[model samples]
Target: EAAVTQSPRNKVAVTGGKVTLSCNQTNNHNNMYWYRQDTGHGLRLIHYSYGAGSTEKGDIPDGYKASRPSQENFSLILELATPSQTSVYFCASGETWGVYAEQFFGPGTRLTVL
Candidate 1:
């Protein structure tokens, strides 16, 4: 099974400042994704990677940067965080990008930008 972990589970950032959220997976899944969901909204994809060194823009890529330096590490960066960007961020890993690929989600990073 996939075991994903995220760091600094909770964060508070200032407007126009920087914030970084990190994620690591143990199961060696080939696909990794970053998502943000507001209190009453669905999962909004921020970024995704098919493998190391390859990153793709998802549904909501603006104001976010993503890095996949290794097979096990993926990071989400907010260069200039805004209050509107604050939300629960999630990291997920999957073996494939098909319909049947069950994504394993890590604990969310709750960000509060003031």
Candidate 2:
């Protein structure tokens, strides 16, 4: 089965502090994504990478950044954490199969900024 893991499952940050969320996948999938879930916004993509050493901005990339150093490791960095950015973050991996791709998601990382 495809598995994805995230570090620091829970976080509490100050308004101006920095926070980093790490994700690792064992699926060997080439496409990885980071998303945040909020009350009304649902799941919004923050960042994504097609493969190792490649990073791309997602639909909502304003306050977040991502890094994909290897096939299994992907990281999300919040240079300046803020209360408005606090949300449940998830990491996912997917691969093309036939005409569509299926994604496997990690548990999630709940972040709270004060």
Candidate 3:
């Protein structure tokens, strides 16, 4: 089964602080993604990687950066956390590009920037 896990399920940070959210997958999939979920807006991708050592910016990558150092691990970094960055973040993994590629998501990490 494809499984994704995230650490620090909930976080409270002060503005301008740095925050790092980690994600790991056990499915050995080739694609991993980081997204933020906000009320009324569907999941917006922040960054994604096709495999290790390849991080690509997604639709909303302005205030975020991502890293994929190995097949099983991906991380999202918030250089200067802000109140607007407060949202639920989710990590997902999927197989290679295909018509049927479906992403399996982690529980989520709720971040609150004060």
* Candidate 2: tens digits of C-alpha lDDT, residues 1-114: 669999989999999898999999999999999999998888999999999999999999998889999999999999999899889999999986764498999999999999
Regions of model 1 farther than 4 Å from truth: 97-100
Model 1 local distance difference test score: 0.94
lDDT of 2 at 61: 97
Most accurate candidate by lDDT: 3
| Better model by lDDT: candidate 2 vs candidate 3 | 3
Q: List the residue pairs that clash in candidate 1.
A: none
Alpha carbon lDDT of residue 53, candidate 1? 100
lDDT of each: 0.94, 0.94, 0.95
Please give the distance, in angstroms, between residue 25's alpha carbon in candidate 1 and its true position after superposition. Answer: 0.2
TM-score of each model, in listed order: 0.94, 0.95, 0.96
- Writing each residue's lDDT as its tens digit, candidate 3 over 1-114 gives 668999999999999999999999998898999999999999999999999999999999998999999999999999999999999999999987677499999999999999
Query: Each model's number of backbone clashes?
Result: 0, 0, 0
